[model samples]
Each structure stands twice: as C-alpha cells, then as structure tokens.
Target: MNSQDETQIAVLRNLYAKQAHLIDTGQHEGWAQTFTADGEFHSPTYGEPAIGHDQLADISRRFSESAQQAGERHRHVIENIWVTECDGSSAQVRAYVMIVGTDIERKQARILRIVTNIDQLEKSADGWLIRHRKVEY
Candidate 1:
C-alpha cells in the first residue's frame, strides 16, 4: 500500500530466500539465526517441535547429515508468500514451500514434499525474526 509497506514485504520475501539458501547449503547455525532465540518450529515431518536455538540448530544439523549420507541435495523453494497481518512490531505470514531433492549420482531431481507454512514473526532491532512456524503437509 504505502512505500514502507512495500519495503517490509520485500524484506520479508528476502528473509525467506535467505533462509532457504542457508538451510540448503548446510549452514545450520545461520539458518537457526533466522528465528528468535525462543522460536519454535512445529511440523509433522519432524515428529516433535523444535524449540529454542539449540534444538533448531540440532535439527538443521541432523537434516543436513541425512541428506549428505543419502548422497542427495535438497532445495527449499518458498513461494506465494503473503503477509496476512502486520503491525509495526509483529506480523503473520503464510507461504508454500516445496522441497526438491536431487540425487547426485543419478543426476535426477524430484519433489520431496510440498508444505504450507504459517509463521508468526516479530520485528526486533536486528530485523524480522520468526517467532513460531507451523508446517502442514
């Protein structure tokens, strides 16, 4: 609507792109930093929700290891990002995330999973951080 609003949306979009790259490249710590210290991630695929920085980073590490052992590379494509609600300090966003996996030896890529992510975000001095994310497959 306004210039400020447009800027915020663009920043949020960039956040998603940054997160995807971090996780895909096995930058576990950096990916976890996209969230707040007490952030939570809930997903059926993970069985248990990962809370706090330590748990978040651990999950990323495990994910990276699994993919590496399988001789596969994964990519996260975040699309249709919508800032459903936004106040100055907080926002609710939704997006579709498609996880694509590539088998290095086979040179084949396939869609691993498609999930919808609903996220609660907070604006801090450092910028926007995800407070909580719920993923539905």
Candidate 2:
C-alpha cells in the first residue's frame, strides 16, 4: 500500500492498543472515550448492545468489577487488524481479539475467549473514533 495508507493503519493500530490498555487497567471513562459520543457496541457476550457513553462506561465498569471480584486480571490482545475499507472520512475495519485472564494469586495466564471485531470508524477533529462495533465469536 501507499505511505499514507501505512500511516493510517499505524494510527488505527495505536487506537486499538489504547482501547485495550484503558479497559484492562479499569480506565472506564478513557475506554468509553475511544468511541464517539453516540457510539454503539454490540456483542452477544454483553446480552445487550451498549449505546452512548454512559452505557459504554457502565459495561466497562461492570467488567472491571467482575474481574476484581474473581481475583483475576484481564487483558485484551488485538491482532490481525485490517482496514477493510477507508475513504479518508470513514473506514470499516476488522480485527481479532484474544481475551486473556490471569489469576492474581496463582499468577497463571490463560486465554478466555477469542472474538472477531467488526468496526465502523469515523474521522473526527479529535481523530478516528469507533462509530459502531460488533463483536462475535
């Protein structure tokens, strides 16, 4: 691809990394901010799609609490990110994510789930943000 395409891919990859880190570290607000104000997240695992910032943050908070209570630490590993479509102002991307969990006391890490993420992204003044995302097994 062209240099511009490479740069865009790098930026998108960085965004994914930031999102992963924010949620893993229990930065609920920061993780929700990775999406647009009206962003939507749909996943079978969540039962219902979280719409808007409040719901997004709530989901993240719940996830954090559940992990904490279980004495486990979770990490999201994003891989095989592909810019399936891009037109400067918007893009469609796909990625594979592996959710790894570690037992805090035992210090044992294991893969919990592997999911595919299909995302619709928009470029805004602030940068590229996820407009909608669908996660599936």
lDDT of each: 0.93, 0.94
Residue-level lDDT of model 1, residues 1-137, one tens digit each, is 89988899999999999999999998999999999999999999888999998999987888788788879998899999999988878999999999888999999999889999999999999999999999998
Model 2 lDDT, full chain set? 0.94
**For residues 33-57, what per-residue lDDT tens digits would candidate 2 score against the true structure?**
9999999999998899999999999
* Local error of candidate 2 at residue 108 (angstroms): 0.5
| Stretches of candidate 2 exceeding 4 Å from the true structure | none
Spell out the clash pairs found in candidate 1: none
Q: What is model 1's C-alpha RMSD? A: 0.8
